[model samples]
Target: MFPGPTGVTTLKSWPESAARLIAVAAGRETADLVVRNGQWVNVHSREVIAGTDIAIADGRIAYCGDDASAMIGENTRVIDAEGRYLVPGLCDAHMHVESGMLTVSEFVRAVLPHGTTSMFVDPHEIANVLGLDGVRLMHDEAVDQPINVFVQMPSCAPSAPGLETTGEELGPDDVEAAMGWPNIIGLGEMMNFPGVASGDPKMLGEIAATQNAGKVVGGHYASPDLGSPFHAYVAGGPADDHEGTREEDAVARVRQGMRAMLRLGSAWYDVKSQITAVTEKGLDPSNFILCTDDCHSGTLVNDGHMDRVVRHAIECGCEPLVAIQMATINTARHFGLERELGSITPGRRADIVITSDLATLPIEMVIARGVVAAEDGQVRVERRAFDYPATARDTVRLGRELVSVDFDIHAPEGADTVRVNVIGVVENQAPTKALTKDLPVRNGLVRSDPTQDICQIALVERHRASGSVTNGFVSGFGYKGACAIASTVAHDSHHMIVVGTSKENMAEAANRLAEVGGGVCVFKDGKEIALVELPIAGLMSDEPAELVAAKAARMVEAMGECGCELNNAYMQHSLLALVVIPELRISDLGIVDVRRFELVDLIVGN
Candidate 1:
């Protein structure tokens, strides 16, 4: 998600940065920053040059070579790199900060220590829910950061119009307007693969606007087919794609003149499968890029972000130097920012990562435009608080209090068993299976089928509620006891998603989440057990990242107590209403068959 590079401060270029580094060397300047001696991993030429000296002046790279003793000023604060490998700062080619469930500032605080100096972010997450105003909110926040954070206006609002209903929808008009913004690098992912393949007028219009403005257009071809549909979509004008999960997918994208962004996100593990094209197939590495498509806050803190992706590429047999290229220079080239901050060239930003080892990538220190932003795996910069508008904050609009009756699915008169469609949640991925099971009826209400691991799932229309409730079934939570989990952080729309082994618990859980404004809540044995309050957009917490993660972990533990055991149960619950995924999904309207891209009655005709 990128517009112009405003608000978000650009780490001054090496030309300017070099001046500061030179001043530092000449004693005429006590430079803003200086790294004494660090091994330089020059990704541009795929070489691990060692014992390199880097100089910074006024937030830009002034001098970068074997030795900079001549550039050290009397007052220059020098850091002893101790022969660590100095690599260009990592960059995420395409990502959504909201997927981490953290505000832009919080996300920055979490990733800065991991050596991510720049991100080409698509704020479509907010755009879908809050429109252009939401995109501006995130854009302004990124502009205030210490590193490079660029925004891309969302090109697809409902992602797949008519197939889904988001709280707000963006059109080509919004795209044209965003092109004028300083930080807007381009249009966000063009997710409507079908629309592109068919040459849909609206999709074409958005692409035309982006092209007219000379910005890169993102692509998302989620379907596995690499046939005519894929070809048609590729020819439709998207410049890059990250949804590929196979070697062939990678090869095809590169051959077609698109950058293949390999991602290893918190839940989406795609890099390992696709990197084989470069490692074993002898494909050119320049066309390949690295990104974390989605990462929750815990993963950001405990694991890493772009750094994690680089390490994973190494594990997948890519040379460490090539891996760094994918994260830095390759990403920069894809976004048309090759001369800016991608490499350790003379004119680039002073964004470099000092590492002791090249293969393992032990980030010893991180420099952003000559400033010491992180040291020894710790963030050195302070996160600024964005003034969130009250209207944009706590947007859980549940029109009425929920009751057990709202969770009820009536059986046809005298029906012994009712056939219910269930959404099968695949762990670590966003795809769901359209499953059906016969459920027993009691007191005129159909019951949840725990034996099949099927729990009752419902979507509550929190945006203007309208007393609308769409009830469906979801599997994979493995709930065995009287526990129900509810969350207001449903994908895209951020409605309330409730899933439970029991209707009573489901009612309690869903209602409690609504009462809490927004957040994920788990209920076990009737009483409210744990809650993760997300007051920001009913999807993020204003509290510190650790605090939100701790609360989130407690919610997961509560789910475990209720006999629900799944990897990252919160992710599973959050995706229940994601219609773009597949098989089956629930909306404020009713059960939707995503594979068909159409809504259907809950009870399929027998």
Candidate 2:
């Protein structure tokens, strides 16, 4: 194999290797590899043609037709497909690698067996903690992979400018500098949708830099109101969006010339509700793409990746060919990479998946860059772990040990009972509901009402070592005992978020993460039940995916034991501090009313 900088297969430019490819296709040169007697799932034409053969030279498809036997030489390696379907390798249109609690290399290793050969990753989660350097780290590691892993320069590090603060900040200059990187696909999801709609110069400058570099701009318009703000956001130059949770949201995005990404992550089940725009309304399927926005390691190892999304789409009333098209060609076309690696077409990278069924979509074998990367649900290649710098670790700086008294919320003067705003979690979705509940006060302090399912939530500042803790109330996880969970992997802004019914348990959870540098920990009745150590930027671990997934499974079980019964409750817990999505969230600043885009008082006085 022709190795690149880090032992990855080096793909020569089409111009540099065009003559060899042409000669191989014309039977004038020997082919390096040949796959014969397979049914090709043609995404471009939406047809499955039988008796197909493909010829490869220098890690790219040189010829694909009914027969390529003429190009095969005595030394050429051949694989008999045995009447299997030769489908293009699947692509994840948008995702975050850090969400898996594994590094880029580990994440790739975990999903390669699932037939995902192409991924458009947004490393904004790390950017929120380590800034541009962190993005560069992930970008460098991504290019060293056997498959295609494109990085999008993070557009919003803090996510919301004035609403929250992070360990690092990325601006327009950073975006411009990153455009010159070899693997940068475009600007990451513009999480600051309000900033884009209001013509914020910083948001526009980043968008302009991406456009000026001739790259696609990703979007995250996380609002249900598709009114003036949504239109303004579209006008600001985001080529695609993956935050649509409704059918109208998908229709609006496609109608406005933006690709709509239907996602089925570990927690977010959005494909069934939004795919109707194409399957039912008769809209073009080319504008709809499938993605896993944020899947944990447990989901990647125990379940599947893009293959799972494709199967789910097929089960959601979409045709098998149409779902495959949505996952492959549609995503490639959106990112302007259709000519490079989307289908079983000549002159493209030789990334194909051999499967026996279309609807079930079992990934029997996966070939990436003309090499057998995985077969029979096992990776066949070696992937080395990328060593992160020491500066990237030990990021959980809580300044001082947190105590139970620090979490106490003093009641106003002498109020016996007061109504307060609560963040209501919506299962299987990103958006939360703004809710209110009345609670009794004892001894001049407000207490969480376990009977009403209301618990205390805190966002502890970990970046500046400020020792600042902002407290709020959230109702959704039906926890019964004195259970608390703490995580440094909070979205957009990687602060420490602790949610629990008991102040003492919450303190213990938060202090444990700070002691371990960073990670997610569950504490019940003053005992640590589960912990997943993520020493890299306090967001990811370099350990093997199986080990991490095992720990994550235990964490999930612990949540269930604590009386929390939400599907993927850990995901919902991690996103509580995401101030971009409505309608309520907590941050280092204070409790944010996302609907109004301002900080609001916690108490409702009569």
Best by TM-score: 2
Lowest lDDT sum, 10 consecutive residues, model 1, at 1-10
Q: Give the Cα error of residue 464 in candidate 1, in Å.
A: 1.6
Question: What TM-score fits each model?
Answer: 0.94, 0.98
Q: Among these predicted structures, which one has the highest lDDT?
A: 2
Off by over 4 Å in 2: 1-10
Residue-pair clash count for candidate 2: 0
Clashes of each: 35, 0
User: Candidate 2, which ten residues in sequence have the lowest lDDT sum?
Assistant: 1-10
TM-score of 1: 0.94
Tens-digit lDDT track for model 1 on 1-606?
111122344355444455555555565655555687777777777886777877776566766777777666667678888877788999998888887778988888888888999988998877766789999999998887877898988888887777556788888888999999888999888988888999999999999999999999999887778899899999999999998878898999999999999988877778888999988899999999999877877788888889988998998899988998999999888888887779987667778888877778877778876677888877787667788788777567767777788888888878888887778888766677888888888887778877878778888877766768788878888888887888877876777888887778877877776676678888888988998877777777777777776776787788888886667767767777776667688887678787667888776663
